[model samples]
Target chain A: MKHYNIYVTSKPVIYDPAGRASENTLAKLGFSGIERLRIGKFIEMQCADDVSLESIKQMCDQLLANPVLEDFRIEIVD
Target chain B: MSDFRFGIVVFPGTNCEQDVAHAVRWLGHQAEYIWHQDTTVSQFDALVLPGGSSYGNYLRPGALAAASPIIAAISEYAAQGKPVLGISNGFQILTEAGLLPGALQQNASLTHICETLDFYVEKTVCQWLQLASGTMISLPVSHGFGSYYADAATLIQMESNGQIVLRDTQARIAAVCNEQGNVFGMMPHPERACEVLAANHPAGAGGTVFSTIVKHLEVVR
Candidate 1:
């Protein structure tokens, strides 16, 4: 069995309104030097060893994330 | 001419199917509710993906529901050059399903907006919006994620192809149609504004939208 960790986030060119709002709130709360913040989703999945990374990429492309406005990264976990 | 039969798709967490059905019936068309699990959607002449947080907006607003089996049928219906309209969260689903080009992100203000707003019609190629290109109409918008985003190339292409159908006074796009002009996605609830209310005169501007679709269907037939 293999476990994969996925992180999905809005593309950099696309505005992150939620993240900006949170950044504003943090700045107001006296958090200094917070350069940037981008809100995203984290998904963990466990599958059989035979499940290829190509298949996982297909899943992300077709269902897990929208490529038009978001990007995703996958990492295999030990 | 026979009345067009409209199918309102109902996802697990959708809340606006009934409103859409009411609007269709009020507009003198037949209305039916199609469940998300149903595999067949070829029966209806038109399809509507109404507003609401489908799948409780988990993962993304419409991500899960976009993958539902019914979407394939909806795709087939759209491929047949029939009209398919998605309102608000339904718009999100269409974008997520690749039926529409842009993605609806969180509103720029990061606030849930629920108010009646004016949308300037920008394109008339789509049968759903048959009004003059510059006409402004009132429609209610209710959603947290209503901002539209697309890459520069896609936006440029949409502009050149006249795919952008509606925008607010501030020039923020509110609705768009696909290349074939059969699939449409908008972040406004036209269904809520279809009633002739005494409080707001000329309040039912949305009725024109539904009527226009029916007339277009009839003409095509």
Candidate 2:
């Protein structure tokens, strides 16, 4: 079996309401030093030796995530 | 009641037919799976197009499914004012079918997103939405092309005409209704959240979609 790592993040301009709300709360508390806030996810999966990277990429493309709101990366390790 | 037959359209790559059907049955309504080859939607109260890569997302998410044999029938049904709903990729198919207006663009980030989104109900005329207040309902959304795109004029018209439903507080539209208001298309899955039997569905409250649709069917009956 092979191991893969996936990292996903939202696009920069899409407006992260969650992050913005957190920032607003922090600013209200006088914690204005936080310049940038972002949220994302990381996923790791193991695949059979015969599974190709292209197929794994397609899986990520089709159902694993929605390409509009999240970006993902796959890293294969020996 | 007895005549309230609902058809769940099946296209190549569609993966949510069973989920939709189970939701329909849970409400004590009749549900059938129809092949993409059927040229006409048979006697039915409503139709549902569930999410998946119909035609392997070829051409466009639903552009090919729109040309499927059963689409003509779906068009006829929509013309007659029967209710129709497309969820996720199903939403794409409706846009491609012209059953609903506005196309689902690639997500703003152009990434595959899977998470429970905070969907606000802007209208109750649609069967899938049950909340009356301006409350945010959290439901899982899994799609690569769920962003909605249309010219500003059309968006304004839809809003003014009450054809837009479920807009986030920031006015980002999450769902839309046809002019006659019988058809609705959204990116979230009420079916997947309908019951606890499915591991992922446990405790998900999106079942209001099925109950509301069944209520509408009762009225039609």
Candidate 3:
């Protein structure tokens, strides 16, 4: 079995409301110097060794992320 | 000349199916619930995807439910230019399924908004909307991720095609239709406003939506 990591984030052009709100809260808590923060999701999965990167890309395109407002990247860990 | 039948697609965690069904029935049409696992939606004259946290809204709101088996049938139904209405979370599912352009992001306020809001009707091309253009109707919006976003080109095209149907008081998009004008998605719970139990009723503006669907079906049939 192989381990894979999936990262999904909103497209840069799309506003991340939750991220913005979190940044404001951080600022209130005296956490400064942080220029920007964008929120996203990370998923770890185990796939059979025979699974191709192409299949993983298909999974990202079809289910893992929405291409319209979000982008996703897949990495094979092991 | 038979009565128009509406199939309300029900996904796991969907709580608004009954509301939608009741609204459809209130409009004098036949309404039925279609499970998410169903493979065929050919029998219904029109379809409605009701609001709720489908698939627990995991990963993203409406993302998982958009990949369910029933969506394929709904897509096929939309291809035939049949009316398909999606409300609140349902709107998210349509965008996730590519049945509609654009995506719904979290509200700018970063809070779950649950209030009766007035939506300005921007266009009447969609099969589900019959009010005169520019009319404002009251509907309840209850969602955290109801902010609508699309690429510039898509937004421009939607505007030119009269697919942008309704906007909130702030001018933010509250509802939109596909270029074909058959598939409609909105963030408001129109179903909730389709009752006359209150004096200052929204006059069941949402019920008018169902009636419009029936009228369109009658014309096309």
Best by DockQ: 3
Q: What TM-score fits each model?
A: 0.95, 0.70, 0.95
Q: Please give, for residues B60-128, the per-residue lDDT of candidate 2 as tens digits.
A: 588778778788888888888788989999999888777887778666565788876677777545655
Residues A1-78 of candidate 3: C-alpha lDDT, one tens digit per residue:
989999999888888888888899999999999888999999998989999889999999988888888899888899
Tell me the tens digit of each residue's lDDT in model 3 across B1-221. Answer: 74788999999999999988888787778999999999999999999999999988998899999989988889988999988999999999999999999999888888899888888988657888854477888888899999999989989989999999999888999999998889999998878878786334486777767777777788889
The Cα error of candidate 3 at residue B155, in Å, is 0.2
- CAPRI quality of model 1: high
Worst 10 residues of 2 chain B by lDDT: B124-133
Q: Is candidate 1 or candidate 2 better by TM-score?
A: 1
Superposition TM-score, candidate 2 onto the true structure:
0.70
The local distance difference test score of model 2 is 0.77
| Residue pairs in candidate 3 whose N, alpha carbon or C atoms collide under 3 angstroms | none
